[model samples]
Target: MSYNLLTSIDNNRLKQLKNFKTIILNGNNFTSFPSILYQFETLHINENPLCLAPPNDFINDKYISATSNLYVQINDKYEEKLFEIYQQIFIENLTSYDIENLSTRFKLSKTDMNDFREKYSHLKRENKIEILLNIWKQKRGSLANSDALYKFAQLIGDKNLVQKMQKTYLLARKIRI
Candidate 1:
């Protein structure tokens, strides 16, 4: 639905043919900055694709400088949407394309979320206890996700994990009551 925000007109080179004094393409997922539009007196594309790369490509300034916030804002927006999608997937028993999409779309193999990345690594290593604990930390407080987590723990034959998750859920329920 949000794709309608940009139409064929937005992506068309004809849009650049206009003798406009200024051009603003912020928040647009433009893969390449067109050379033809460089004649503009003002151009603002900071939050778009070009800013996602290392700052050195554009300028020598460090990320702590003024240029950094634009990229950070994009990442923050992405993370917020990812969280919402995760919750919805849990509720609907849907599979998350998070891992795949992040790789293909965002071009991120790994992120700076250390705790979460470490937990994911633990799952990859099949470190049973640590993986179980990470699942609880990640999904426990939520209703649908917690149920899915319980089932996963069962499927893995970790009775201890299932009991631990049950204990926390029951304790939280008691407190809520």
Candidate 2:
């Protein structure tokens, strides 16, 4: 059997809807979703400019799934890139001093470092870069001494910084001071 549902008022569907386990609404104009949608076991509402605020019923109902077009796609890409960079950095065991030395060696602006910190909270948690550097000096460690410093220098594409870091490592080793 085939069925069709139509209504002008957004609430009308909710009021009339009954005995249906699944419903698919596509290519419709909806500023906000009705709470009745939460009653359905499965609902597919795609291609609608729903308000940014998620329905309270959906949030309260743990079983219901609501996917927003705006957040899901962009967040997914951001998360993927974040993880990729994180793995590369983690494998080399990048330390705080290494990050700072590399930043200075590469001439990375404060904004760039801030952006990296915002995107990768794990680095902050690992004690590589504290949220408040001066407040927690003793917890800080040097990445400048690490062999991974070379790999980080190469990633930044700054030959000058690479050379400077190499020179610093050599000088520190020779002086043993």
Candidate 3:
């Protein structure tokens, strides 16, 4: 059977490490190198044995090298990735005006609405109706169309407040432009 090399320390079958081309160690229980690990072409050993250093040959080897020696000094990449994750998390929380401002600020080719939907599918499902209502109200404007006012009334679910807001909107609309 083909094996996935990126096994956690808790995997009982890590004994089969000899069968894989690469191994990613993301655990702390490892006190020393497993003899089976040397068979791998690449090894990603992270956050273990802070005092221990890789030998010069291991550092120079084309097939096997330590991650510590390869420094990724990239501020721009980190910033871009951070922005992507943030957009993924917070897109639904933002208003249309907020999204437009963000698009302008970032010079994005497309709005992050899709990314948001993908990342927060479960949360979106739980709040779908309310979120859509909020978005519709935001798009339709609290003071614009009569249909929008009716929808806003449905959203508020209050007769008195809806009438008051509709009257206020009418009064405001009548004022000099």
The best candidate in terms of lDDT: 2
Tell me the lDDT of candidate 2: 0.48
* Quality of model 3 by C-alpha lDDT: 0.41
- Residue-pair clashes, model 3: 0
Per-candidate TM-scores read: 0.35, 0.32, 0.25
lDDT of 1 by residue, 35-69 (tens): 44444667676444322433344435332454466
Q: Roughly what TM-score does model 2 have, to 2 decimal places?
A: 0.32
- Which regions of candidate 1 deviate over 4 angstroms? 1-21, 31-42, 46-51, 61-64, 94-177
Positional deviation of 116 in candidate 2, in angstroms?
28
Candidate number with the higher TM-score (1 or 3): 1
**Tens digits of per-residue lDDT for model 2, 125-175:** 445433222222222233322454456556766555556556655653443
lDDT of 3 by residue, 1-177 (tens): 223333224334556555688866633423344444545677665444221333444455553333344322122233333333322223333332333343333333343445545544576432543343344435445332344434534463445545555554555334311
- Count steric clashes of candidate 2: 1
Q: Can you rank all candidates by TM-score, best first?
A: 1, 2, 3
Ten contiguous residues with the weakest lDDT in model 2: 131-140
